[model samples]
Target: MTQGVMSGAGCACQPVEAVTAETFARSWSGVSALAWRVPLLAWALLVVAWSGASFWGPPEMWFLYMTHWGLLFILLEMVFGVIVAAVKTPEKNPDEESGLPWYVRVYWLLYNITIPVAFLITIFYWCILKPASKNTHVNYAPNPVLDVMLHGVNSVAMLVELALSRHPSRLLDVVQPWVFASVYMFFTLIYFFAGGLDPWGNAFIYPVVDWSKPEQTAVVITLTGLFLTLMHLATIGLASLRDRLIRRCRRDSAGVYNEGFTA
Candidate 1:
């Protein structure tokens, strides 16, 4: 009787092993098909488009122009390559869906590509454009649209990753607020001191401080710096609170899975 029970258990385990192996083989074969190839081709087209536009287009349209075009390209690639392809054949197992979503994969690819492009644009602006325009006395204002778009996307991405990843330790939760505050304070002091000296222009592109009088400029710079510092702190605090709430919601939903499985 003991030998018969052991044989029955062995038979049950063998089918599971066979099923897993078969599923893996099928998934691998599907992955080996056009999934990656289509994305690669689209990415190549994006590189060509961006390079051509930068090389041929006017200097004024360089940064934002290229960035916008690159984003559009990646968006299209995601829709066609990842979403369309994945939907054509859905995986039956929920465990397979636990991996990254199509949107996240596309976002990461775009982010990776954007980093190099941003570096190149910075080099071009500083090395070539700035020096050429320096003697011409052209006061170029920073593009507020580009700044907001880039930073906003980055912040959203960070929030998404934090939500999806497993729960953070208490240390990370505590350190996050302090790190943000300290960096904000450090930059606030630097901006205050630098603005007081030149008051007419900022360290980067535009000047917010009035430089007509030394005493007045110092006062304006100090006040502006304090305002910006407070703004940064508020932004950080709100974002941290929102993220914590989102994480708690995800944790609560995850708790249902185990109970349902047992029931």
Candidate 2:
């Protein structure tokens, strides 16, 4: 009878109701729990095994490298998040007050933000930095399996959880990334002045941070900071987009039209 309605559609063509945020969240509550726990369990198993087999007797300071530190942060986040989710899921209420102190909350934020950072770091290193530095770098044979699991899968699982799970809100506290980046920036400065030697035998952990060329190092730092900021914003935007896209898709499949959405 109507352009949007099927010719054989009877009274079943009544207007469809819009799915609100709360409804969407409730629908995915069980999914969110499973999504986070699954990857977290995998991360714990892989890292623990990797540490035991490969890092049993390595230099203690080798743990200070950003890549290693990032892994630790990611692991901590997963473990703690799973434990807390067991106690009470975020789907319960994101704004709900936790009796925990401010420092603990800060820890949560860092790990949450670290997920995308970890992924972006690996992407930059493998896709661009590694290629450009090959001429000036020494070649070494390493296990590609663990490398992908660490660099690629670690980052991706976190994001997958985000896409599959529903957050209370799409607007994350945007300032959290700045704080996380600042703390690491402070660490880099400490390593620089303290004569910290990286596992690579260089004074700087990252090749880009090598101080021999002041001009290049400065450019690297500035560009890196900019990139981090941009990425943080991009991830936040993705959260919003993911929420809107999923909702719109569900509504369309159900023959529902959202007033806020346009074809």
Q: Which candidate has the top score in TM-score?
A: 2
lDDT of 2 by residue, 169-209 (tens): 21234356556666776787787788877656667656666
Root-mean-square deviation of every model: 15.7, 9.3
lDDT of each: 0.35, 0.55
Q: How many residue pairs clash in each candidate?
A: 0, 0
The residue-level lDDT of candidate 1 at 251 comes to 48
lDDT per residue, candidate 1, 1-263, as tens digits?
11111121132211112122112112222342233435444554554454445432344333323234434444454343334344443444323442434443443344333323333334434444446556544433244434433324423333332223221112112233333324433544455556522222333222222243457546644654454344334333443454346436554321111010110
Determine which window of 10 residues in candidate 2 has minimal summed lDDT: 254-263
> In model 2, what is the error at residue 255, expressed in angstroms?
19
The 10-residue segment of model 1 with minimum total lDDT is 254-263
Q: Which ranges of candidate 2 are over 4 A from the true structure?
A: 1-29, 55-57, 89-108, 136-141, 168-172, 252-263
What is the TM-score (0 to 1) of candidate 1? 0.26
Candidate 2 residue 120 C-alpha distance from true site, Å? 2.0
